[model samples]
Target chain A: MEKMLAEKPVNVNEEGYLLEFAQWDKDIANAIAVEEKVELRDDHWKAIEWIQSEFKKDSPLSIRGIKNSGALNIKEFYELFPGGPLKKASKIAGIPKPKSCI
Target chain B: MKNLIILGAGTSGTMMANHLVSKLPKQEWNITIVDQYKTHYYQPGFLFLPFDIYKEQDVKKEGKKFIPKGVNYIQKKIEKILPKENKVQLENETIPYDLLIVATGSKIAPQETEGMNGPNWHKNIFDFYTYEGSLALRNKLRDWKGGKLVIHITEMPIKCPVAPLEFAFLADTYFRKKGMRDKVDITYVTPLSGAFTKPKATAALHYLLEEKGIKEVIDFNIDRVDYENNKIIDYADTEVEYDLLVTTPTNMGDDLIKRSEMGDQLNFIPTNKATLQSLENENIFVIGDASNIPASKAGSVAHFEAEILTENIQNYIKGKELKEEFDGHANCFIETGNGKALLIDFNYEQEPVQGSFPFAAIGPLSLLKESKLNHMGKLAFRWIYWNMLIKGIPIPFVTAKMTKKGKQITI
Candidate 1:
């Protein structure tokens, strides 16, 4: 069933981290997915929260619509975290990067 | 031996009254202030009213609350200014003054624009400049589930140029929280081709607008408001249908200025931008929104003018040359929602440049850059405006002259 679900490939290469830690990832991802909110995996959560708190020079929530100003870019993030999407890792870490960005 | 009479008890007048009443010896010169309304509104507070951030009572208080004991307040409508005689005609009596200071501020004259005051004036169309309109729109927004909510500017030369953009940002946050972010579609319309008056500011603001998914209708000349058809028609006949329309109407000077043929066609008092003295007559002086000074007519500009005009008046009385020291200085706090804001400081000779404020190379507030510290300053100003600014207590190092101390280098 996991293989069949993985074959669909609905999200992207950027979200591959969920596949690596599929065993424990289900708990946090479920909470985020159920609320229709963006979920950050444990490691990814650290980056997003850090960027919002320290890296962001503008306002606190100013990272909302800004581009490339995020904790990690999708392309670089995907290359660095080949085993799993940082978002999945970020969520496990309790970080939330809004999926609202274009 | 001569008395000083100030017109309009708005922000500029209130400040001048406080400034002069404190400095001028009580028996030496009598100060009289005139206005039709007795309510003194925290004008900046009006921007937060519709969002429930500021309530009706929070922004409004009696005019006398801020006025000092020695200063006399007259609640009466001004009929006309006979500058040749140096007197102002009120409803039942005439006021003669040795020196007249015009601080009559501007107002939202939706009636002057075609089709603006039609059947749909406040029903489908609304303005947040007045207390009544803000409260009315707040109610409409509360029950509003979502549709095409368009924030528009009818024309240029509007007060608080950055406000409409802030309103759009807040509305986006408001809708998303109600679980209706997907249900609402927001659009921002402006008369300028850019999102803001200054180009650099526009580029920064434009990026935010795009990020928030707010559509931009640039260079739109609002020809008329078709209330029955539920659309705003542009000069070229382009139209945007809206379930709800919020706008900043064309601001005009006092009615007396228009009636007496002493102001521009839009009712703005004609004046020397450099000296802050009225052009209609030599003895009359204008400040704040009343003066037709092609600049952003904000409260900070008035504060800058107050510093110069108070001295200029003394110079005039001392039989000295009227100094040409007035340069339009306006600084504002732009709220970007989510507990952060932007602080911009600019003047007539210079557009807004990114730099630190109050000190050279060391500032708690950075210009052009956004920070949570700026947001705190924006929030703390309300207390300062009421207790410090209006009472004429000087803010350290924030003198009228624009210093380049904390300003960034232009390499």
Candidate 2:
């Protein structure tokens, strides 16, 4: 957490915009492990890491990938936070407010 | 009696309406103006609206207030035009005239982009070009806790090209005032190679952009908005995600021009280089954004055109030889925020040369130099636009022709 926060342009909260996708989404998705209900097993972290690796050059994560990471389906994952991952992740990670921002 | 019909009540049309009312013999010609909107906006103020420099009410007034008496103002949407028949078809009635003037200004048509006007419009993605968009952005900014705010321009040929830059500067100031400047990251995205159309202005503005710590992303040809993924992707595979996206959509001429036989591919009327008369049909004339002139599409250009065209129209009506006169002069006050601004004056033949305006070397506000005096001068223009410009009163010290006396001739 200290290392991610220490890195330049890593905090989406600081820039208010997401310059890189892997850093921005993963910033939020990685923090999901800290949440009380979330149990980010190696498989879940692997899935997010996979999405980041493929998408570092501009590939974005798909909803189907959540299942590949051994997490629930997209709907069940969204059911974790009423605000949903896109909105919650974006706000927490400091990605500029996407269309889904409440 | 010869009928003169103007197909808009915007800044240009209203100015022309007042000028013609004063110049033409009311006994000889009846002037009729058509437009759908009842409220007249100080369009220059739209740039200030999002930044809280100007409120919606501050820049708005009833359209009929500035309209001179004896000129009939009809609030109606124009459907089509038959230039060959010298007639305009509006929703309520068909206006037939001896002289027709098309002054309907251009507008942002995001629908031209495949995914531009999708579900994310005005919600996640906002445009500050219109009154509603600016007002909505004001609201969005108020509630914003602070984060990556992207000020993006879809394409150029937009009215007041410097407005987006002004927005970035003002946003920096606004967020700072709100104690969120530390958290806010402002990035300016443009398709242009520089911050401005001119090299000099870009160099000067680049310093300001750098001083403000605003990230600059140049030559971004945006392909589409992936709303599901929350990112704006370019053709070259560069994706910039944002918390909020402020975009200026593609500006195009009015639909009526397309309906008429006189307009170009983008629905802009093809007018003579010097004369504002329609190239396809001489009886018809177009000014302001609707006209496809090499001149910058601006209110100042329209004001200059109105002055020159009035004389041309009078000469044409008298069967006298038309003059190859108008030189495409356009001037603008670029707001640089912190109560300071810069002024740019140029014409068709000359680029925006670095020099003071009007008085030249001895200026209260420096030319091509940013200062508080220019900001105050810009603030004062609102009063001038309402009292003098729209009323057709000739602005002293200004003319249709570009004067080289005060300007530094560029290479």
Candidate 3:
């Protein structure tokens, strides 16, 4: 129910995960993060940036990827974004919801 | 022709029906499966229903669809099992069997816990084990703002032991997505001192709880549900309050088992864990959640037990020694939320260890480690459950027995 700054209508799935990757921006990420109760600390930005870049390169983003990406380890990634680190981080980073999430 | 009657056309019953029809000569054996309900629910899917990960259609199918053509599928309420006479009494009929398979799986009994069925039930208190309970909890969660979301287990030996933890993890993700993570206070209350029964897995899962910021209330043996006050009081007088209580109530075997006086205190048939043969009666074999085995009451355990039981049943019919022995083998995927899950495979003797599964050092799925591939594997299981498992078709790599080939014993 939170508003995003997208000029075109931003479409999301039933769970509020963005359906379109092109509609994502830092503003949208901030808005989503705020709704998620995340303050977007440096470590959080590092993970978000890594996932976004991985998406652009067409590489699969995973827990192992985040661990090996040197951006964050498994423990830190979970601390930065508790519960669902990869799914939540990916959503904020503007990627399609991963198929494995369900 | 001799009759081999199986009670409850659920997971084990359906699988036994499919497995036996092919092995037992139709000229000499008549296979019949009886249950009270016409629909068979994929019980594992109930864990996802509360999170909206699985819909009703995904988990439900006609019970008769999976039963083979040669077998007789009866839909009737079982009155009692006269094991001494080798007969099962239905409401209107008394069916005789040369051999009987007690697959009348367990059920969640909220009434066993005082005050659990009070006014708050289905309003503020809910369970996700049954179809109706899951559906009700799903609707309640959709518009639920934020409050104390407590996940409690009334006791152990419940079906799918890891489901409560999975529910808590999913709830955390659900609330985070709804932008109310901060508004919600999540707590996990269990009878065990840690997240799981196994120590190694507990250490790993305990870290997951801390990482998620979910508080743990361990060693809380629930004595009663103070429903009006929205509190659960343990035997030690310890109380935990909650706005929404999602609990796994006390699980027990079917009421018929209790009436027959053929089961343990919990109504679970006392069976030889290795042989699957009833300790009380030789003609009766207990499988799945019906047996009082130390193993987890899970579908995978049932599948494994069925393999051994099928062979034992054949041996019994042939007047040969029952040679097959079941080793409490069970494997399950623990959904950790955020598109990742963990896999654990073990048996009665061995606990889950950190290693690759099915292949050594080159696993597409990692054991005791969270990965997206495991999550994908878990999701794909829904398809397998419908198509292959119930049909008695063997999965490519996994077998009935637990293997240490790919597992790391040193931990």
Candidate 4:
């Protein structure tokens, strides 16, 4: 699906997660963060940057991964993104939702 | 003769030994498998063990019974793998290998969580991922007056991902059979978003949670278990109290991976998802829960990978291009209790769907939907696991790759 983010057309999934990392930018992330009702503060960007880098490296993201990441503690991670932090953070960072083999 | 050393004589290693013993020329290649333990456990039975559906004796046997006559089986601890040198360091001696297969599978590390392994360990808090834990939980469940029965998963990538859910379903059945269904308030907690992660599976199976009266606590990334308070505190500070906590703790690969400096943060080896070969070395192959592949760490996945790894090993020995043939296929029976089970056949690409299995329209077992025949298949799997699966015998009508013929993929 195509959606307007940051006043530019971008590819996103049904849940509004950006499909292409190349299409992601700070403005688009800010735009998605607003949609998720999360205000992008400095700490939030720290997590977003760390998670985006991990995503680029193809590391499976999880709360445990975040705890070991040194970017933020899990409590701060929850505080920054609130409910389902990984899902919202990945969306804001423009990565696919972390999945388990089901 | 060249040497082939397989670590961890569990499901994958034993299957590899059986498969390669016939395939590799005796004069050319010598095979040896090592594990410190003598007993080869039927691990899937651990799920049923707590409910008294299976006795302790039913799930274990001598490990030597499964290895073929031609292969050499060693009962000794493996210290580390010197992969660059193409050698393995055992407890007392160093052994060299032309090829190495690491099947040193994952296990529960309850110590990873704060207060998990503290005073409440195995008393109120329990894990059913091991023989000892299962037996302890069985004894606990036998006499316990139930209150809040929590079946929790601390993290993902746990072996047999559905076992906790199965535990909850069987608990419902068990309590009902014991005439104590009304007393036990069962809760299924997970770090995942829901009971089932895939689309079709969630759609088909979500009702079971409500139907069985099992409450769900989703997106629960547990920070610590406050044993004194009798509640699990998540990162968000959300607390779920329980009287009896059956948790699948942080499942990590063998510490030998850490000692060898060959694994990721979780100690699972990085491997080619399709080929099952270690990304770092061509000669080292990883299978089962040891590899950090995106496949579920289940015996069924190992069984499928063993088939592909056998072919790849043969290819590598002949100095040919490796076959990227493993499709992350897994076939599992999900016991839904009440004399019914759900048989799901899926791969890295496909989510389990509703349809007949093995046959296009005519199945002895149905997929996704519950059936008595599927339950029978679940019971019969124990015999198959011992007699055929570990012995490298191809199961009748079941292939290594996931078949899309009978499945209703679209709907």
DockQ of each: 0.01, 0.01, 0.01, 0.49
Q: What DockQ number belongs to candidate 4?
A: 0.49
Chain A of candidate 3 gets a TM-score of 0.83
Q: Chain A only: TM-score of every candidate?
A: 0.25, 0.37, 0.83, 0.96
Which wins on TM-score, candidate 3 or candidate 4?
4
Report lDDT (Cα) of residue B224, candidate 2. Answer: 76
lDDT of 1 by residue, B1-411 (tens): 568899988889988898888667666788999989989988888778888888888888888888788888999999998887888999999989988898888889898567778888777789988888888888888888788888998765667878888788878878877889798889888755456545456545556777779998865657678878778886546798898899888777888888767886566787887788887687788889888876577888888888888888778777888888887777778887767788887776566777888776787788866788988998898888888887777777787877766766352
Write the number of the candidate with greater TM-score, choosing between 1 and 3.
Answer: 3
Question: Candidate 3: misplaced stretches above 4 Å?
Answer: A1-102
Model 4 chain A worst lDDT run, 10 consecutive residues: A54-63
CAPRI verdict (incorrect, acceptable, medium, high) for model 2? incorrect
lDDT of 4 by residue, B229-277 (tens): 8999998889999999999999999999999999999999999999999
For B89-146, candidate 2 gives per-residue lDDT tens digits of: 8997888899888899999888855566788888778888888888888888778887
Question: In candidate 1 chain A, what residue range of length 10 has the lowest lDDT sum?
Answer: A58-67
Show the lowest summed lDDT stretch of 10 residues, model 4 chain B: B192-201
Q: What is the C-alpha RMSD of each candidate to the true structure, in Å?
A: 18.3, 15.2, 18.6, 1.9
Q: Can you list the residue pairs that collide in candidate 2?
A: A12-A94, A13-A94, A16-B147, A16-B148, A17-B148, A96-B242, A96-B243, A97-B243
Identify the superior model by TM-score, candidate 2 or candidate 3.
Answer: 3
